[model samples]
Target: MRVLAFLDGTLGDPSQPYVRVDNTGVLRGDGIFETVLVVDGKPRELGPHLDRLAKSAAMLDLPEPDLELWEQAAQQVIDNWEGSSEIAVKLVATRGSEGDPDAEPFGYALGMEIDEKVKRARTEGIGVVTLDRGFGPDVAERAPWLLLGAKTLSYAVNLAALREAGRRGADDVIFTATDGSVLEGPTSTVLVAKGRTLYTPPPTVGILPGTTQRSVFRAAEAAGWTVKMEPVPGGELAMADGVFLASSVRKVTRVHTLDGVALADSTAVHAELCEAYEAQYA
Candidate 1:
């Protein structure tokens, strides 16, 4: 991953030692983050991403980040990179361990170039498996420290779930509730299309409210289709016309096979959704 790190208004290589001291984000994973897609040199769904980042920070009790400063940092990096049509920018706000130790916050922005092959997964599709149920529906709803809806730096478990899925010959994992209800994928939102209606697990159901999914829904409506959000059963995905994992990097990719069962290749829905988002974002 080619990376550009911003420290105190200066952009430099991430290999440099310019990270501010006493960053709780590195020390204790005490930070909130948002990943956004930049296409044709403009960030997509910027308003919603910032809103969600603010909410996540509030949920974690972190200080408010300077949104304009972060936006300038992103613009600096975006303007410098030439010929790169698309990339993913990660904005993070860390509770700086400076001054009063309980006062203002510090944070940084990181931008990386994502491979075209990865984004092309929208057309090629992916495979998914179910991880061992560690964060179930009931537990996530009741656990006060669960950070169920926050996109924080505590991503060890998310990476682990993806690793376990790969070990099982899958590209990702769809976490299931203890009672067998569907939750979400490791780093993406699950979208299953049944006819013209697109369904996704609701945010109340232990899933991150995805920005890409929001844009896709808007574009879907523009294309004359209805969208539904409710409890999604894991089994229901297999019976749908098509299944997709939506994220900033992956965009929208079909889940062609689930747990070794080959899903019928419904690339047309994939094409429609991809075109919808691309026309709007890319």
Candidate 2:
């Protein structure tokens, strides 16, 4: 792994310990993050990822992100990374130490090789289980403090959901609202296809707006696929022509089964979308 840290406009060595033990980001998970894909040493969709990071930071009342500084850090890490065809460049910002409320936010960028498991899942597809997120679709609108749309570091619940899916013998999880509306995966966005029309839950459903999914939708649209943003019921996956989970690191992965029930074959559609997605990076 290659890393660069930005501490008050100063770049620090990533391998060295910079974060204090009292940082609230570690203690309370009061932080935000974005994982970007870097191909051939260029970070893909960097502007959008930075924009989303700013939004997440704003939600947490953390210091405004200096995009220029982050860009420098990311570039440093990417330039130093070697021996990998692709890398995952992660940008993270945390609320500073607990005792010093006026301290600047801690921020860093890390570059590492993409996980083999994620690559394998993209190549061979995966099985998923539906899990309740314990919140309704309208919760984000009703309660803003839960930070439903922010990509904060408080991910224990999401990790727990994934573990539960593993225990059920599935590769991933699709979170549903208490009312049974499809939300998204723990680390990915959900998309279902019916013929040429592709459907994904709207951000109003309290799921993070997926940068990779947005890119895939743009590519899918150019390829003559109709894209729709609406509420998807948990039962709709079984009836759809195909289903997929999309994210930056995982790219586009086909869902072979949902809750042990086989979904419609998505081989052709998956191939087309994957081609379109990779074309953007090229």
Candidate 1, 1-282: lDDT as tens digits: 445646367777767775466677767788888887888888888778888988888889886666777787777767777546776888878777644556457666677787675766666788888665556666657875788888988888889988898789888888887767778887898888999999988888667899988888889989988998888877797888988888888888899998989987779988898888788743
Per-residue accuracy of model 2 over 154-260 as CA lDDT, tens digit each: 99999999999999999999999999989999999998998899999999989999999999999999888999999998888999988999998999999998999
The worst-scoring run of ten residues by lDDT in candidate 1 lies at 98-107
Predict model 2's lDDT versus the native. 0.89
Q: Pick the candidate with the highest lDDT.
A: 2
* Candidate 2 least-lDDT 10 residues: 2-11
Clashes in model 2: which pairs?
Answer: none
User: What local distance difference test score does each model get?
Assistant: 0.80, 0.89
Global lDDT for candidate 1? 0.80
Q: By TM-score, who's the top model here?
A: 2
Where is model 2 more than 4 Å wrong at Cα?
Answer: 7-15
